[model samples]
Target chain A: MAKVYNFSSGPAVLPHSVLAEAQSELLDWHGSGMSVMEMSHRGKEFMEIIHDAEHDLRRLMAIPENYRVLFLQGGASQQFSMVPLNLLGEKKSVDVVNTGHWSKLAIKEAKHYAKVNVVASSEDRNFSYVPAEDTWQCDPNAAYLHYTSNETIGGLQFPFVPTPPEGVPLVCDMSSEFLSHEIDVNRFGLIYAGAQKNIGPSGLTVVIVREDLLDRALRITPTMLNYRVHADADSMYNTPATFPIYIAGLVLKWIEEQGGIKGIAARNEEKAGLLYHTIDSSGGFYSSHIETPFRSKMNVTFRLRDESLNDSFVSEAKKNGLVQLKGHRVVGGMRASIYNAMPIEGVKSLVHFMQDFARQHG
Target chain B: MAKVYNFSSGPAVLPHSVLAEAQSELLDWHGSGMSVMEMSHRGKEFMEIIHDAEHDLRRLMAIPENYRVLFLQGGASQQFSMVPLNLLGEKKSVDVVNTGHWSKLAIKEAKHYAKVNVVASSEDRNFSYVPAEDTWQCDPNAAYLHYTSNETIGGLQFPFVPTPPEGVPLVCDMSSEFLSHEIDVNRFGLIYAGAQKNIGPSGLTVVIVREDLLDRALRITPTMLNYRVHADADSMYNTPATFPIYIAGLVLKWIEEQGGIKGIAARNEEKAGLLYHTIDSSGGFYSSHIETPFRSKMNVTFRLRDESLNDSFVSEAKKNGLVQLKGHRVVGGMRASIYNAMPIEGVKSLVHFMQDFARQHG
Candidate 1:
């Protein structure tokens, strides 16, 4: 069909190679006479898929030995509540850094379970920048300090992790930025990412949680939400999202073929730089919403000076084979989400389209 | 490539045509220039997939207009806890019928949320037979009466759903036997099945619930666990198991291509009858655990009288391209789970192998 570049934020782009390999193996995976979708989760074939996917992810993320990598369902939205349910049982209060719409939502969900302390927020400035980590007023006796590292809605990101006081753990919702760069796995007690963004698919949410935080969930925590149960069963306390897991495994293999997280990260940075530099050089024709230091490398948000030109820009871009360039509803501007699978060529084409669109409207 | 038949229960077998279609569309679904896994859940492409899948399922199952079909994650195991959390909020107790390991597990999980009362049990008989519905003492004021229609581990099945007292709802855990035959959807308030068995894959659980049961969830229930949220969103409140949903949709289409559920059910009966006849005609050489009425049409469980022939039976059967014939560890015997995707030829070949093996061992 159509030669196109998809930039729909999440359930976004995946490596073409991963999908190709998965399609080829869909019917009779390795001559087993059944698709991976039809293979038993408890069977030898699926066991290998799960084992290798987990091991590859651990290696790619440099996860510590004590950390449990869980392939869970319900996405990061579920984790918004699950984190507090699992972590804030002992303490009555949780410290949160409100970056944007997602962190605000997370804080709202956590309120049902615990007393939330909004230590710092960029809300006053319209979430156009990340509040400095030094300004965070963490609760020393708090169970955990949580923050959203990258806000998908606002196209904002924290350049560094917030430091919590002693006895408090740091938790980050790294949904939009995970695997786009290397992370120090030991820095946080827990980190969760919805796979729709930078990882594989939407159904799967990858959680890298430290062992120490596995226990101590409240009595009200559903057995399915218990981190310890999933960790103990290796994400198989119940049947997992097998097809997503299999496709994710294929994505992981693709990442390895691209020389792991480091290589992919470097490529992502280059792609992001091309788009950002193009916007920067546009000389008032195009304006980026987030301040320079806090802009996301994964999603570059910009706007045109002429408000009415937005429609033409998006529609014309679609005709030019660049799709999903419209901004998120909450943010009325344009956004190009250059996720892990987005090639430099795709970004270059977007930059070309943006420049052409600017010239036509200029 | 070595040809082999996979007999692992649930995530068991899929029609080869379905797999071939999925394989063909893996990278670029219907020329959308994106894999179904990579499409946004809210986008039109993915929405079409969900709508068509639900429509196809409703037609295949003959689900009533009042029933809301939900595609959920966390499998049937999650439903064990969610059922009580959602349905048991207004009532003081719920009734359960224990037939085998899975039903017992369901009861165990339900007890944490509700005062679960065992109405009838076959555990006294070593789970070799189903407890009759007439013997059940379900409380009229109970929230719901639950039963596992087909016990996966013990290979027992309730011959029919127990008639609940007028005010109490009847719920069936049809995890292992959904879509194997025709059923009256109006008879039960809710029917759930994990897709791995006969539907499509793990991770996606199909819940057919009467719309009235949507409310009454406990205050502390996770938003994702609430059936109301899933029903309202058409099972897209969060990012769904898109790839598996696509596969399930394809399977539904394949079912229609094979002359719909009624036609497939008849074929299933013939296949099951052939295998059961093989065991019964073996003349004391092979013994089945479950009574005739409770024997499953999907999973046929039988053991040689000598018991010493078990290993040799599984081993030599593997040599003839049959695999995973071993029973669950909790129940030591041979189980051939011939789900919907298992062709008559496969069963005929399996029967011939069983006959040859019996002649040699007997």
Candidate 2:
């Protein structure tokens, strides 16, 4: 089989080692004579696997004792609805920072369940930058302030956490940049990320919610979506995504093996820096929409100045084994999502591919 | 490692070959150079897998063109609330049949979202038998009449599909008995099952919903829990449980290889007969709580005449490679879940162990 690298944003690349280990255990997990997929969720074996995965996640994040880490199903989209349902108890309005596509979607979903206030937005700049926190309109008594820390499609990110109005809590959708950077545990009320990007697979969602925010869910909230029910049961109240949890655990183990988050962030910065420098040096040939200060270090979106060459670029790149470089349909161009499992070599190869592509069309 | 047969109800046993093949493809799926877990949900590779899985499932079940088969997350527990939220609309009442643990739990969740009528209940008999359908007091104006076709814990099953009153659709929770026997798909308005038992894994829930039932969800329903959203996208509005879907597809392939559901059901009956016969031949030494007529072909529930011998029977059985034979916590004693994957050899071995234990205890 020819070697290839996957560059799709989420449900993206994973370490080959994790997949190999999973394969080896597929038929007989830990000598149980049944695959993890076949083991009953109520069995001792699966319980231990889920428990260890949750513990490892909490440990990796250094989650404060007061916070609960929930391994939930239904990607971040579900969280968009769950967030408002769980926290909009008595408040009529929610403060939102609309930075890009994901945050805008979050706000749209929130509107169905609460009165939403767009405290700040970067939409005026075509979602290329994060709004300055000081130039904002926020409701002091609002239930919670929500923002997307990293916008995968726009390749933009919030450089720093936004402080919630006094007594209010800050919530972030850190889908793309979650494990790639160091985050303060106490600064936010809730942090959720779908597992397709920095985590493991696509089915799991990692929710880091404070303990105090547990019991405020609306009466209409489904029991499965209730944080209190999930937290109380330790995310096992229902059968969880066992195989994905195991894969995520393995990824967490790999992170620990590679010197934790600090090590990953360093590599991510180096990878992003190299690719951005290549694009910048290409003069007018290649350009990126997200301004330098707010650009994402994970998914680097760029396009050739000669838009007509885009099709040729993608086709030529595929011949060289680099795949999924096409940008999201909402933003037509190319995007290179270098997630945690993406090695330095993969980035170097991508930079090399970009330079070659740029030279052909420059 | 000792070869042990797992009889845990759900997360139960699967075809050994499926596990072996999954293990072989762990690191790289079909030369894609990425695990199915690693591929993006939207990418062609993973999409192909999901599409194939859905197709195989449709073919295996011979799903009608009017019904959409959805692969959803959050297990049957989530479905408990989702069913009423999606189907009840503005209706205040829904009818339910109480046979055992699962039906009772479903009714409890439904009460949170709608007024529930006890159409038929076997609780008067300690849930040991299914009430005759002719005696049911179904409400004609209810939105839907729900019943659990098989009770995993009580080892009880409805002998026949009850006729729903006019304007009421028949909904079945076949979580414990789906795929064990064939049923006319046209008889049900909706059929749902968690995959851990007769299908694939726990994270995936298969919902076969009628087309006409897709558009009436209440406004309070979360988008993820809305059947319409799933029906519209064909269950891919967001990232799905990829690995579970892959594993499930493999199981479907295995079923086809074994001559589809009909062939498997014949084998299942043979296996269940041997175990039930073993218990019957023991005379008064062993007996089943579920009456013979309503006894489940999927899960066999029984107890020794002398309760003290229960522990010894389980322990010695484990020593002889029989595992997870203990009954559910709610109903304690012994349970042998002979799902589609449990082979005849496993059943014969279980019978051999049962006879040995009976010789000493009886």
Candidate 3:
């Protein structure tokens, strides 16, 4: 069976070369006579893998020396609580922008640790656009301003980074779009993403935080949940997701070979352009509610003109070897999550299928 | 090169068959054209993987209907805090037994959430023995009795299950010895094991708890850290460690093929017996501090008569294709963690090397 384009929002696609490399080394990594999964996280081989992964990521992101990159677990959902538990030290409140599903969940979890102020929201428009920065009610006294850089479910992405009040920091959940584009690392106080999307597999979450923000965890924070503890220990406070980290290293290397984030971003723009063009020229057969400027370059969401054709559209798409194209259940349409790992060819295949499906139903 | 016996404590060895299976399915799983790593957690393929993993684990452990088996992340270290955070309820204090490294860590973390009673400790003897239950200063009103079933670093295991005071539950950290031997499911209120040993891989932690214990989580507990949230969501409260869970399913299937826990236990006993006998009959050339009955059947810790040879001993062991035999740095000596996946032949090879080394250095 030929490989198909997998457009799952997360735990999403990975570079085929990385998977091939991992397969070749699955049993005896570097002639160590043990699978990467079997090596101790403290062992030299595994340590090297983790170090290279961090180093490559730091290079790719052009991360500053002031930032600490941590490989964590429990996905982005765990961070929804951990971010507040660690950063909301003396501050009683945090300013949050509810862009979509992920941001909403983050707001809910943060409320358990601190008073949450909804600074801005796109819910008024079904989360199809990013709220303007001037409309945001920035809390000068809040611990930080939190927002989702890209909402996988809604396929809406912030066009610009929001600046927090003078004393407050900015924290962004870049889960779906991390590494798909280059960004100024110094612009944010913290950025985190689950590895499944562009990094590698599930089980590992990458956290990039300014080093100065390490010491402010609440008194009740668990040692594992404390960012300071992880940073102090080099993310080895305990047994980490060792194999996932190894695979992520392979992915980081692949990205470098593809000419770093800049090259990858160019490809992502081209892929998104092709898919969005198909949606725009569908002659009323398909529609995308997201405003042109806010449509995600990573996840392109659209719907058939007739909702009744949704099931057959999905089934027939699968038959043609394009799978996981169904949008999030909440949005009720179709979404093609063309992350960094997604090839332009895959997007072209998807666009072709979308056109065919629309013509038959039209 | 032939596969070597991997003796790393956690992130230890897994069966070759499982690795082969994983490799074969690395790119296109079951003709689905998407790697298991790429599938969405909500997708049917990934759902089936998680469900089968939980189901097989339940069957292998003979876990009762009242128990909720959760596939969590952050290894066992996360549970060190979560256990107390969720189970302490209105009880201000909990009882803890200091067996070794893991238990001591658990005790330290539990203190952040609850007042801890050091009911009993083997720390006086350098954690070489399990303190007798009769000697325990039982806190009758404590929330739970927390203990380490097996200490990976010190190679000490409790010979008998410590009975908590009536109405108090027992919480055991079985990170190193889970599925190594069979025990009554009713013997403890909860059992949590990090999946690096005797299971699949790192990043996924399995928690088996009584259903009734789920609701008592502190209001301050992070939603992801709360057991009730995980139980209700079937451990899918967020995008879980999907690939790790799938690998765990494969491991569970392998254990079943090895005749379930009972058969695995008999093999474990035999393997551990052979290695321990080599140390015991070393004619004072090597020694184990653990009391014979309390010695762990998973991790076997010992030392050479002459400490000067420790480094060379480890190097020579690696040359003989017996690697990761060096003990944890905290405990300076040697530790062979022969988990469920370590074949009898691996133990035999280690025993052979031990005798040869003693013959030259004795």
User: TM-score: which candidate is best?
Assistant: 3
Tally clashes: model 3: 0
True contacts kept of each: 0.77, 0.77, 0.83
Better of 1 and 3 by TM-score: 3
Give the deviation of candidate 2 from the true structure as CA RMSD: 1.3
For B219-265, candidate 3 gives per-residue lDDT tens digits of 88988899999999999888899888989999999999999999999
Better of 2 and 3 by DockQ: 3
Tell me the docking grade of candidate 3.
Answer: high
Best by lDDT: 3
Docking class of 2: medium
Runs in model 2 deviating more than 4 A are none
Task: Count residue pairs with overlapping backbones in model 2.
Answer: 2
A1-362, model 1: which lDDT tens digit per residue? 78789998998998888877877777778887667877778888899999999999988888989999999988888898799899986689998988888898899889989999999998899899887767778779888999999888788977877778976889999999988888788889999998888778778999999999988799888888889999999998888888888888888888888888889989987998898899999998999879999999888888999878889998899898898888889988898888999988989999898888778778
Listed in order, each prediction's TM-score against the native is: 0.98, 0.98, 0.99
Q: List the residue pairs that clash in candidate 1.
A: B10-B196, B11-B196
Error of 1 at B160 (Å): 1.5
lDDT of 3 by residue, A1-362 (tens): 67688888888889999999999989989888889999999999998999999999999999999999999998899899899999998889999999999999999999888899999998998998998899999889999999999998999998888888897889999999999888999989999999888898999999999998998999988888899999999999898999899999999999999999999999999999999999999998989999999999998999888999999998998888888988888998999999999888889888898888877778
Task: Quote the chain B TM-score of every prediction.
Answer: 0.98, 0.98, 0.99
